[model samples]
Target: MTDFAVAIRVYYEDTDFSGVVYHARYLHFFERGRTEALRACGVRHCELLQRAEPLVFAVRKMTVEWLAPARIDDLIEVRTRFVETRGARFLLEQEIRREGRLLARADVEAACMNRDGRPRRLPADVAGRLAARVRDETSRARSTGD
Candidate 1:
């Protein structure tokens, strides 16, 4: 499957004392990719907030690897792939790449939650559509062996 990807420029503000991207900034980059991916797939966060349950997706767990550093002015691509979904949870695999080389990788587990902050199922129809899209992509990826 073709992973959802977003190009991000590492600016001066994204760097730390030594001029490399601050470690925590990578999380923001990953979030932006996921947000755009959902938008492209027809789920809008603003609309989600207007639902009866006023729902949102929240990251419950994540693991990240810092393989290399990104410096100011680096053009990084944040790529996201849906791994799976079960009940109120979803898993995404993401990577930060610079010039086709890996800078970092992360696996994130997200849970659907209501305004009250209690775990809840994602809107049924929305989840179904997203799941279908993910399945289609998975099939194509396997067929192409990419």
Candidate 2:
């Protein structure tokens, strides 16, 4: 599905001794953004896991770049986008920004797996929904040249 943006406030727990958000905390922000994006597309992780062919998504690889430090009390936005979709894998591009300046960027590759942790094809309906969302986003972008 098309990626979505989620806004978050940096909190004390997310920071390090230097008073800046811990490096690992950015991953948590990205995770929440992805989860909320999926929910917006009507795909709930728990509900998907309850299906006959239960599936879970796991990050296969990730490349992250830190451009700036975010501190507690900062209002940040996590923007996530699904860049590619394959048989049982997807690539996502995510960025964390504050006041229009990028703070961090990540390229994440994720795979869908069954309970046994083996790769599995996403359900046809799920794939269709995701594809439609992507197409809609593309069309909108084209129209707005965004």
Candidate 3:
């Protein structure tokens, strides 16, 4: 799960009058990327919600940079990495690229919360799974001198 990527085609609706993607549209792409990345880790939102004590992830903070524009009809890949997982929160780094060229980047912090909207620590198993991904990626990077 080092860098899970989901390919997305820029649709006409995702762009503005000039055919360039609207700044806000990148957020949608990033969100989709994060969702898919979690799914790749075998963490599905529906499963979390179905637990006896339901939980959901909410974005707590995000910082983004729009390095370049993605125009309609372009095929872009959203790469997401789960960098850290703590008590009730996790951090993600994401990038939108077109053919290996960076287009935008975002750093996000997401909190796990109960249905009542109060923060709740991630289920132990869930946390362990995410932490394992971080560890695996780190060890691999070190071995490869990345």
Candidate 4:
């Protein structure tokens, strides 16, 4: 939808000796963003695994840019946009920001996979739901100029 956002508070464990969030920790933040976004669309990972043909998602590729730093205790928002789905894969764009200031961003490609690790087309029902959510949000955003 417009962009699913989740607020997070930076913790000491997320920071390095320099008192800034460690680069790799940003990945974790982005992951949480993605998970929450899916949840917002009524898709839950646990439910996916319980389907008739169990399914899971795996990251195929990602590109990230770190534009600024977030220090311990800083509150940040992770915003995720589900770009599109292609074959067995889906694309997402995520940004980490603090008080409207861009901190980092990531573009992700993820694939749906069977338990055996072979790529599989996303379940039709799941894809439909995601598509509907995207469409609804797009219209909402357009109407509000968000």
Candidate 5:
């Protein structure tokens, strides 16, 4: 599987009193996917923080759509991809799927920021690698509007 694929199992802690996954948990899965995607491309958050530029990725905005609910014990996959890149900001499209069923999707815009929280341009090498992995995929088996 590509770096975009991250498998996560919903646990008791991820659920609400109803035994259904708490809405906020989906965002956590997406975050992991984004982090792993960068790692697969040879970039790491700690390394970025240690660089001379000393930067971190901060979510500037996010729009999430809930299509279905995932319950505890469900095996889910969070798929992530770069949708666009503009200067210090990049847009990511992510989805939570349970056995090929789309449960939720989100569009996240993140910015590279310095320790002082000032916007900083993404490192050239990092940006290039991210762009190389950029993709927009619609379901072949079922379509969810992008």
Candidate 6:
């Protein structure tokens, strides 16, 4: 199981007039986290696109909780974990943290879709690799009692 962590700095453009990160910025952070996570697992999105079965993943649902405000210039870490993968969809748990404190959390459900935008099953090999990462992450969490 593989989990990925990406560090991002809140920029002035990511904030509102009050200098705090805007709500939408969290979604962007999560997107980057997911992309990096896949890359770390040796699954490049571009390569996926070039496959014979060429497919992409799209968010089916997202539930987010804002715990604290993040200000511009703050170094934030986006942690992404593949929580589950089944059938035609996968669930991801992502969080935004600053100095070990969770600033926001999101539960995302994503579906694999073909170029025509219809739901598709993930290739067996791809799913197996993703499942391995999920299992590893779960084991690490259990070991840490988290």
Best by TM-score: 3
> In candidate 4, which residue pairs clash?
none
User: For model 6, how does the per-residue alpha-carbon lDDT over 57-123 read when each residue is reduced to its tens digit?
Assistant: 8999999999999999999999999999998898999999999999999999989999999999988
Report the C-alpha lDDT of model 5 over 16-58, residue by residue, as the tens digit.
9999999998888989999987798788999998998799999
The local distance difference test score of model 4 is: 0.90
Instruction: Evaluate residue 75 in candidate 6 and report its C-alpha lDDT on the 0 to 100 scale.
Output: 98
What TM-score, computed on C-alpha atoms, does each candidate reach?
0.95, 0.92, 0.97, 0.92, 0.89, 0.95
Distance (Å) between predicted and true CA of 67, model 1? 0.5
The weakest ten consecutive residues by lDDT in model 2 span: 125-134
Clashing pairs in 3: none
Task: Give lDDT tens digits, candidate 4, residues 17-111.
Answer: 98899999999999999999999888899999998889999999999999999999999999999878778988888899999999999999989
Put down candidate 1 lDDT per residue, 14-85, tens digits, no spaces.
999889999999999999998988887888989999987799999999999999999999999998888787
lDDT of 3 by residue, 21-108 (tens): 9999999999999999999999999999999999999999999999989999999999998899999999999999999999999999
Q: lDDT per residue, candidate 2, 1-146, as tens digits?
A: 22588899999999999889999999999899878877887878998899988899998999999999999999999987767677888777889999889999999888889999999987777676666667777787788887
Clashes by residue pair, model 1: 1-141
Candidates 1 and 3 compared by lDDT, better number: 3
Model 4 CA RMSD to the hidden true structure, in angstroms: 1.6
The predicted structure with the larger lDDT, 3 or 6, is 3
- After TM-score superposition, what is the CA distance of residue 117 in candidate 1 from its true location, in Å? 0.8
Write down the lDDT that model 5 would get.
0.85
Candidate 4 displacement at residue 103 in angstroms: 0.2
On the 0 to 100 scale, the lDDT of residue 22 in model 4 is 99
Looking at model 4, residue 12 earns an lDDT score of 98
Q: What is the lDDT of residue 64 in candidate 1?
A: 97
lDDT over C-alpha atoms for residue 72 of model 1: 94
RMSD of each: 1.2, 1.9, 1.2, 1.6, 3.9, 1.6
Better of 3 and 6 by TM-score: 3
